[model samples]
Target chain A: MKGVVFVKLSEFVEETWGLALWDELLQEADLASDGIYTTVCVYDDQEFFSLVSLIGNKKGITVAQAQKAFGEWIFTELYAIAPPGAHDFVDIFEFLHGVQNVIHVEVKKLNPDGLLPEFDFLFESEKTLRFHYKSPRKLCYFCEGLIYGLSKHVNQEVTVSHVECEHNNDDRCVLEVSKVG
Target chain B: MDKNPPPEALDIQLLKRKIEREQKARQIAEQQLEVHSREIYQTNLSLKKSLDYAKKKNAEIEYLTKASYDVSSELTLFDILQSTVALTGRFFNAAHGINAIFDGQKVQPNSKPLIWSSGGFWDQNIELQSFFFKHFPLERAGAPPEWLIMPIDENDRIEGQSFRWIVCINFELGNDSSVWIGFLSKSELIDEEALNVLEIAKGHLRSGIRRRLSDARTVRRNIELQETATHLEDARKQLIQSERMASLGELAAGVAHEINNPIGYIRANLQVLDDYLKEFKSTFKLIEEKVNLTGSLSKQEFTDTANKQDLNFLLEDAESILKSNLEGVERVKEIVEGLKSFSHAGDDNLKQISIYECVGTALRVVANEFKYQHQIINELEKTLPNILSNYGQLQQVFVNLLINSAHSMPDGGTLKIYSELSGKNLLIHVEDTGVGMDEQTKNQIFNPFFTTKPVGKGTGLGLSVTYAILEAQHISIVVDSTLGKGTCFTLGFTVD
Candidate 1:
């Protein structure tokens, strides 16, 4: 996990709840970086989940909801890291398709130390785009939230579902995104 | 409080963002640099591999080129095979080699097993010969395998200069014949690439051998042609002499008549002379009686006896008959002399002789062939310089020319024989104003058995024999003929 993810999350927390709440979550959580994250550094994966859980508890929500919201909130910030052709996708499905081919290649070049997920596609139909997401991190919910954010940014209607899940002991997660009427 | 920070605080925030941006840019640049370096390293490695391959191929090409030169430089098949053995022995890292060939004539080939070795040529070993034939059989049932490997006396000994292992490769030509190149070494020589190159070298070797063999065959055929030419020369000379006598035989009737006419007259005149001798004897007896008995006889009785014998007429007629008989005998002798001179055989020694004599003898022998319609204009210069030539053969040459000319003029054309002087050379021209030949026939006039006369009318060897005889004397002959005009044969003799 790059520190850029944490930095984007902190900005999202501070912008929504104010700097005071953001600091309270960071001070309470045991972070090696003391929650002073820089984009160029790599931090512990558990530390990221721990901070997300702490914020979820304070807001009286489930950890899944908080993580999902954080993924949606931090989408625009992470979108900045995408290489040129990954932007301006016509819809959320197009953006998801570009994630593996266009965005990930450039991301790997920039942060080679980061363990990126393997992305393969199955064009089940013209409207339905199914992609197999295989990663040790198993961030399926976060990926769903990213899709939700991308749909809003591109101003197109989309429905996201999963035919298989890593959480259910499948080797990879197959997320199916479809255009909505 | 304002949502925007103070100017000093804004400056610090802007500076932090600037530092992070610069750090990220530097990291991407470093990543690109490493990737490019790795690619360059891989390219360098590939180029090195390609260079190695090219060097190996170049070495192979040079080796085959050297072998080609070796194969071509040698003149004989044995030498070529020997040279190939030397080249391949070193190339395949062998200690010894043997080359054998079968010439397809007989099962027992002219197989000289020329062994090449680092030491020298073949060191003859009777045991090795037996061992070789045992492995490579003389009458193997089918086409032999491309290669064969067999173990030699494997006693690990180099002192006796024998190999432990041997590889025999066979290059087969047509006619169940092949050239076998066998290499021997203490260790196995199993370089496949070298063997592949050896196959290409085999092509050069096969053609080189083919050329060498073709050369050898040509030389052999040339010798045979020379021998045939010699035999033909001898036969031709014999035929020329025979033809001289044969033509005379053809004229035998005319010659016999020329002799018989004079003999018939001389015989009749001798009978008369005998009678006259008897009459003179009677008269002499009468005279003797008159002188002895009365010492004087009457003129009336003498006159009466003389008139009874007709002495005046006998005296005049008998002298005339004796003179004519003597001239007849001389005519027979001249014809016989001509026959003897014309038919002299095998006397091909050159002597200084003029063309006029040859023409004269040729005319006398072939005179009966001419007719009242045929005109013999012997324009041969009597004072022509004498040239070196065989007398009998030259006369036969002229006889053949005259007969051919006479035959050409079947309807009785002029047969003009003449000679000219040109720069210390004598040129005899035998021309006929008959049905002349075209350019094509004129070109082949001197070739053997080439003639315009019908099948049985000509042997076609007249001008060929004449040309051969003249050629032997270092003389030149040319034919100038045109259709419906005339044909002339010019013999030029360098007579300085």
Candidate 2:
């Protein structure tokens, strides 16, 4: 797991639930970092799972649902921080495309040991793009939320559909995107 | 009240179930949003690559336009190659380069490569040229592609040198004319954009070579046309001169014939008048004798009549005057005949005749000119075979030579005419023992309008016309002379 993910999760929790709930989630997670994170550092994947699970249990929602909500909330938070090599694109599509190449390349330079997912894209049409998401973490739902957040930032309406999911016995997650409005 | 209220507990359980369903729905929605973001990100990466490729291609095209303009502006091969090298270096960031022409032969190892380099000439290791020819084999293949890029080994570098790349391009200018441009640089590797630019530069070099060759061909053709025009103009002038000389010969022959007829009658009438006067003197002397026998007239009267008539002086001078008059007419007749022969020689038929015999005939024709002052010697080669030649023209040439030989000596001298067979040629030599010409005079002796004779006494055309005649017959003449010694004119005629 990357420290950026942990830091984004903490911000989302504190903003949506409140400071007390964030402290409670940190105490429950028992991370060695004690819930503190820097975007350039790497963290254990187990810590991220523990925090998501605690949030789900306290909110009476499933762990998968918590991760998806976190995905959506974290994108808006990441934009606010506006790190170098990010938030410089004019279009949602441009921003989204930079995630794997430009933005993630910068990320690896900052945190070389962090695990990053592989994304392979096939442009389906003028208004549609499709990609296969591969990672052992199976965070396809989180990727879906990031797409929506980007579209919202650019004030464009788009649909993100799951063609296949790793949970359904697929080797990799596949997603499709199309402009709706 | 009980520890837990029944109504509140039921309401809390219902609220938890509703929230669970709503949360599951929200999860699905958020997942879709994430998927779309990833898809757009992937697409943008692909688009960026495409955009970069397009930009690179556009820049290459621009380089091609500029290179083409620079190269084609020059009209010579070396100029074209120099410009090509400069542009290629600039485009590829090359430090040194060679633009060579191999003449499509087996390249020699020691041969120097034609090059234009930024840092001045470095003795390129001969191994490099050999290696280039070995791989490219431009001898068999006229051109080595329009564009090529490859790496030069760092280990192949000369002492302290650091270039690591080589790019070669070929331009075929037709007729096995080809130019090769090779660029060398210290850069580690050339990118695809620079390679693409090299391809376009190759195109520019090709057209530049083609245009220069075309211009050179045009210039050569123009020179040939001008030469042909000059030759035609020269031939026209020669034709006009020939026609004028032909007409002058006809007029001279006509005048000689007309003068010869009158000279013939004048000599005969003068002889008849001399004979009749001698008869009259004899009859007068006999009548005087008969009168003296009869004693009819006094001696004094007879003597007075004889003296008044001047009979003795008339008797002495009458025969002498007639003989001198006849000799004058004969000399005029001989000169008229010589003029006629010389002028009408153009009409004489060609035949196989001994060149020696022609010299004999010429000696007789001009015997009068030499008989007075010079001894004529004939050393004709008797073993010489007959040659096919114009008899009258050969005679004329010999006659002119004999006359010139006679005029050389005011005092008596020897004139020797001889002939020999040398190879396939008949060589005739005319030697004179009279005053020869100086070096300056000998050089211009064969030129028209050049004569040693006082003006009006000579036309200066004798030797000049003889030269023209021999030249027309493909005969060569050489005059060897030394002042105060003698002149020898050697005529060589090819005999087949």
Candidate with maximal DockQ = 1
Lowest summed lDDT window (length 10), candidate 2 chain B: B239-248
Candidate 2 lDDT over residue span B1-496, tens digit each: 7877686675666445435534653564466567767877998998999999887676667668777777757546776677667766766677766766655654433445655467555456565555455445365447455566667665666567676766777766566655677776778767776776676666667667777788889999999999998897566435424433442353345445445545665666566667757765775776588587886767776666666666666666666666666766766665556545444535434568788767765664565565455777898876678887777677667776777888897788988877777788778899998899988998897777688888655567677767766776677899998888889999987787
**Global CA lDDT computed for model 1:** 0.76
- Fraction of native A-B contacts kept, per candidate: 0.00, 0.00
In candidate 2, stretches whose alpha carbon ends up further than 4 angstroms from where it belongs are A1-181, B1-75, B108-111, B120-140, B143-145, B153-162, B173-177, B195-197, B230-234, B241-255, B259-496
Clashing pairs in 1: none
Error of 1 at B388 (Å): 4.4
Model 1 ranges off by over 4 Å: A1-181, B1-70, B73-75, B90-93, B101-117, B134-164, B173-175, B188-201, B223-246, B283-324, B344-351, B368-381, B388-390, B397-418, B425-494
For residues B141-203, write the lDDT of model 1, one tens digit per residue.
235435566776656444566567777766555567767677776665466787688778867
Q: Which ten residues in a row have the lowest lDDT in candidate 1 chain A?
A: A33-42
Tens digits of lDDT, candidate 1, A1-181: 8867877887788788765566678668967766656664568999888888888888888777787788777787778767888877876766776787788888888667769887788666778888887888888778878888887788777877878987778767998988887
Q: How far is candidate 2 from the true structure (C-alpha RMSD, Å)?
A: 24.0
